[model samples]
Target: MSGERRESGDVRGILHPGEQARHRRLTRLTVGPALSAFADRYWVVRWDLRGRPAYRAEVLSFPCVNVTFERSDLRTGGFVNGVCTTKYVRELSGEGETFGIRFTPGGFGAFTGMDVGVLRDDSAPLAEVLPAAAGLAERVLAEPSDERRCGLIEEFFAGRGRAGDPHFALVSRIVTAMAEDPDLTRVDQVTARFGVPVRTLQRLFRRYVGAGPKWVLCRFRLQDAADRLARGDRVDLAELATDLGYFDQAHFTREFTAEIGMAPSEYARAASPGQSVAR
Candidate 1:
């Protein structure tokens, strides 16, 4: 988002399609090839609305982790965010900026000593993880430009002598499969396909991903629903529900409304050209 290498599907799984327009500009910079093994991208978000209303953005987060620095407070240092199982909601006000490192799925296991499960849906101050990191936020935010900000984070992770989980590659493969395959709507499907026992799959996800297999499957499927809705594609509630492996249309509607904070029809209307939806 900072550099010139923007791709077509940079954040397809995180932000709902067509939803980025509601906020101030959010951009991502590709990591130097050195950190590509673990980090997916470096994201920068800036908003300057001192005289205007606040903005809010919502999404069902992917099962990934991030190390984030917010300029609003320097004493808090920075935070290492773990995978979130629930929907994500952020309300922004005033003028501020943040730099974030979104780790590839299961890629953060090593950095946090695989305390992944404890960090589920939570954040730990970077100072708590490594005392030497106490000044990281202040140092990074002091940079004059996004490019230099990302460079600071990149250099930190690139030089850190940490070891990743042995299952990182395996988990990455499985997660990639879940994101790519539409028929993968059940944990059982993953187990049967991968020849991994249900218990093993559960442990891998809990320890490395900070979420269970079922949650990942459901979240990714819901992402598909959001993608279709945001794109203005004609969607039949019943058929779409079945396509997502829901038991029935009513079941889909209830869960979708609960997780997305709106009915599917309302989400469609909000995602239409020039319309904005925030939760």
Candidate 2:
């Protein structure tokens, strides 16, 4: 499956895990991070299969909300469709079967006046949220008009206000920095930069992000490396290991495989042009 583009109405799609031939589609007005053009006019759909040893035979249905943090679970079943203002990072297993449809970043701004975040780790009840989102997905898949779609999203967030308690502004700053540049900074460095104690910083991360500073940083760094590989950037895996704060090439590969469920070379091949893998 090399370089074959599929056309489905106004959506153009691509599949990921080229070798396995899994069925996941990404439909968006544009491909990259720039979302200025579609501000107040679009939304995104994502079906993440981040964790699952093999393809599972369950279909997930859930309500849509905005997600701002990275999720690192080996998920198998679920479908996500909604508008979000934050970045998403996930690790997939079980053949990497998932689909996504993204609206322009600015497209949903008018609708979701407030930002939303959803986390469904082992602690949360996936069954409840998945069903709610599934109902919304049925409406979205019906091919509603742009204005109607935006209105539905707006109502969804309006009903669900902020999902959790608000942390201090300092915590927000730290999380944003980790999301933006995971490798350039460290937990000790964050404390030093903000003049806070390490324990205090760790507490902030745990309370707000559900993970410690080091775990968040490593996840983002792996995402950065994955993005580079997806876009066909060639770098010495060994050098990338050192630059991204890994112990060595072997260490990097091990971490990458554990998180991404595939070796770097395998991912690269799957993402190559004409391959079925999603970018």
Model 1 CA RMSD to the hidden true structure, in angstroms: 3.6
Candidate 2 lDDT by residue in tens digits, 231-264: 5556567776777777778888888777666786
**Candidate 1 lDDT by residue in tens digits, 152-251:** 7667666664665567778888999998888888888899999899999999988888999888888888888877667655667788888788888788
lDDT of each: 0.76, 0.44
Off by over 4 Å in 2: 1-22, 28-43, 46-120, 123-143, 159-168, 182-185, 273-279
Candidate 1 whole-model C-alpha lDDT, 0 to 1: 0.76
lDDT of 2 at 138: 44
Question: How high is the lDDT of residue 81 in model 1?
Answer: 89
User: Candidate 1: TM-score?
Assistant: 0.88
